[model samples]
Target chain A: MEGRERKTLVLGVIGADVHAVGNRILDYAFTQAGFKVVNIGVMASQEEFIQAAIETSAAAILVSSLYGHGEMDCRGMREKCQEAGIGDILLYVGGNLVVGKQDFGPVEKLFRKMGFDRVYPPGTMPEEPIADLRRDLGLA
Target chain B: MELSVKQMDPEEFGRQRQEVLTAWPTGKEVDFDEAVAYQKELPAAKVMAAKLAQGKAKGVTYAQPRAGVALISEHIELLRYLQDEGGADLLPTTIDSYTRQNRYKEAQGGIEESRSIGRSMLNGFPAVNHGVMACRRVVESVGVPVQVRHGTPDARLLAEVTLAGGFTDFEGGSISYNIPYAKDVPVENTIKYWQYVDRLVGLYEENGVRINREPFGPLTGTLVPPSISHAVGVIEAVLAVAQGVKSLSLGYGQCGNLIQDVAALHTLPLLAQEYLKKLGYPEVMITTVFHQWMGGFPQDEAKAYGVISWGAVAAALGKATKVIVKTPHEALGIPTKEANAAGLRTTKQVLNMLRDQTLPQTEELTLEEKMILRETRLILDKVLELGEGDMAVGSVRAFQAGVIDVPFAPSRFNVGKILPARDTTGAVRILDFGCLPFDREIRDFHQERIARRGRDEGRDPSFQMVIDDIYAIGKGMLVGRPRG
Candidate 1:
């Protein structure tokens, strides 16, 4: 194990969303891969993630929403993070993020335009995000 | 205080019913005596418990569809179409999302909006807002026995109002509804809430009305191992039976593997009975309801039919008492009534073609069945142990301890430790067991199966398989193979 403290990650299901299974898996995967995960749980506001990130010096904030109301709930999250002084925090959002069966390309593009570092389609596993966190946080 | 697995006193339940009834004016319309008498006069065909018994006796699987609308008239029209056209043997009045959240005001607004717009607005019927008489109208209009299907953590009022409104069957349980559908609701609160629900049903049973209680079986439905769902369903059954509810239709979601799905359907009622007997409620009537694939569906209607047929075959062969049908428009969101009817017809057609045919028992089927029984017992045993031999207390503590976790459940109360993925054969196997109380041999079996899949795929068995399997059905595949 590395002597230095594990890089911190703040994660939660943003908005009135409570989809927990994948959020927990991400927590397990990241922690198993040696990261300090700050799980804010569900119904989390953007400020909560940013606040946790600031408190823990988190390198990334993983946001999940499964209730299909994510777009409305996730609005101006980047702006909120910016105002919270954690603008550069690696932000990832995923899970049935929209209300209907739209193309994932457009959905991902939409979230990207909103300033998310990465956007994943629903049914995404932890491997991709874990790898992304490793590479993005310069652990590799 | 922790709710022990015990029956609620009748007067206490009556008092609780008063508060629940007064939550809405419609609730006030529920006269338990009249409701019980109304249910007593209903024909055998109009009662879900009786229909479930009939299906069990005939050794056939009935088809049920999830459907609801904002307006009461439209809701009845939809049920009539499904009954006359779809040939569904069972019916469900799906409660609206607003009702599931106990937001009756918003549900009332949606109903008003639907009335004005000349179209259904809300996702489902807000039975709570519509109250008892309206629910009775829906029930009276339907030929088949109707069940109230909803994802509600606290269904106390909904249960009282619907049961008193003349519905003969109810769906949901503390764990089944809460862990998968909610995020922050405490499991302890839900368990206590549903205790009132089960006790209410028991109250009806005491009044000579038989209401079939089915615990929603497809938790997080995204690759849940049969054992996890089985354990929860069995726990809920034990709790319901303890409260004196007699008839139950414990359900399981089709996991796509015929052997495994059939195995799940076979083992669920058995597991429920096994636990109920062990827990001192030995004589409860138990039936199995197999849910059609609860995962992602193909956008193409024909491909979706292929899935529906596969599920039908599983249900028919598995000999599930009824199969919850999914529509061709699943990927596109809430389906039209026509699409809903079509899905039911598709399942009925497949079921008819396979009448009296059963999946011949094989060594593999037997082995899968045995593994499920064993794995489920391990979890349930740990739950009892954690609760000091009480299921109600154990259920809350089990979730707290990560001993009975539902995979992908959004409940903060659920410790999300288990990660499930399809093994080489497409049956779900645990990649990360989390805090599941499986013994070493059970753990080895899962590991070996996953390891074999990894070796066959020329890749390490990782969470990548979970992602692949999730999108596989949508892409016309069952196993998510890596792209060449």
Candidate 2:
């Protein structure tokens, strides 16, 4: 494939969360990493993510939530994508996914149940994922 | 080719029953300047002068030198960097000593330090909101425009704080459980504050001081619909009181949640379209966070949130006048200088790139893209209205009552809710209602038309339409002049 034609990634913060600093950084880093990234930014709803993915023919939808209520805010995001007919589109979520102190084991289970393809803990950096992505997509 | 001209059409005769409204440059600003003077003198000047004199006598300075140095130095560096690199500078304002131990004070100080550090990283940028008197002191001592902020018991105190800060440019108190409700600085305080500000302008007129008003507080963070609406209303009200007030500053405070809402993003554009039409492209400041609950997320998650989409929206679409960027380490407690700097650096990098990139806009929008934006805006508006209604009854109560505890809103539109609907019988039930707007329909039509035109031109649809319609619509409206 030519260098000009690379798959795009649609990324954002879910629900009513307004944390933006991390989102900005990821947009820059991803661009540097050579991914055509379409960043929807914070407080983006599931529909916004799905639609952006469709419009861009994106390879994945990366959802970042920092307010502990991610579990609450991000619940069913995966299912919504599937219903939108992009069920094959990969969904990745990270950050503190639940409010206060919640059990990680159960939270992971809950997210998996909700439909996320992959889930990371509060501090999962983007570099590792991009590396994994390269390997998974045979880019490496 | 000669242009076809409709020459000598018959001129309509006599008895014309039409009223023609022509642009009458009433030199309104001149009259406004005088009114500004009168209002400033009446109450604003006296109250501010007395309060500022008192604060100066009391003299609040940086409390912890080590911590203060760390914080202040970060600010200085950030300001210097941005100035040197981006050529984007800010008002000069720095804190002396800040509160120790208390979470709220410490939080406020930390935000200030980060802000200052970022400011310093830029060249030719000055600090703002140093303190009421402190700001004045800096302006007097340094001979640069200084930012001054005040928090008082009431509207009268707001006036006093403004005066004490040696500023006609000022922001209101914290938007938390206490300060905004304090009997002295009640929600009605803007009324009082502006009344006094009006009088102060009058005083300035007599004395010949060129000062404008800068109003800031978290209108978006209110978890209520009218929070921002009310904040705008108050600004307009104050402007009415002080006719010559040149500028106004308003923003959401610590509102990571609101920024996350697709609906809230649209509000800035609407505000720019409406209230700020006359300002000729005023910078609208907005605040967004990265960490969980504004902090406490792991580094990777935090970085993603900070750098990826969240930051992109804030800079590209939000068209923020000034953004108060939060660090990931906030949840862990006060950020070390390194951590704070890293966050600022990341933000700076995003801003730099966005400037170079093409973003989405509505006017030159694709049908699908425009549909998404309009639907998102509509959903968010409805949700915010509900949230606002709940806020009117008290947001804290609403939160407790579970009205806004979860993100789910009932499905009433076909585009559907951003939050997920319940899953029953292994089938995910989605809420769908509402028709698309005319603007969105028009956009979609043009997108299809462009695609067809591309086919005729032997070019790819996406190729010919390289320009981002959604961004053009969003940011264009945000920074564009409105049609009469």
DockQ of each: 0.23, 0.03
What is the C-alpha lDDT profile of model 1 across B1-484, one tens digit per residue? Answer: 3488877776777777788878877777778789889889989989999988888998988899999888889899999999998988989999876688787886787788779868665668889988888888998998999999998888988998898888999999989989987877898888878889998898789889999999999988889999999999998998899888999999899899999998888888888877887877859878998889888788789999999999999999998889999998786666777888999999999999998799999999999999999999999999999989999888888988889877777676878878888888899999999988889999999999988988889999777688778779989998888888
> Which predicted model would earn the best lDDT?
1
Top candidate on TM-score is: 1
Prediction 2 TM-score vs. true:
0.36
Model 1 TM-score, all chains together = 0.85
> Under CAPRI classification, how is model 2 graded?
incorrect
lDDT of 2 at B342: 48
lDDT of 2 by residue, B1-484 (tens): 1111111111210011011001111111122344344334433332322323332243211000001122334444533443343232233232221111111233344445446644221111122223233323433332123344322212332233334444444443222212222212222323333444444443443455434443433322221222332233333323422333333433433223223332233343354334333333333322211111222233343543453335434443334444444444543323444554445555555655554343344442343234334433443344334445321222222222332222211111111111211111111111221221224554454345444444544554431121211111122221112233
Q: What CAPRI grade goes to candidate 1? A: incorrect
Model 1: what TM-score for its first chain? 0.94
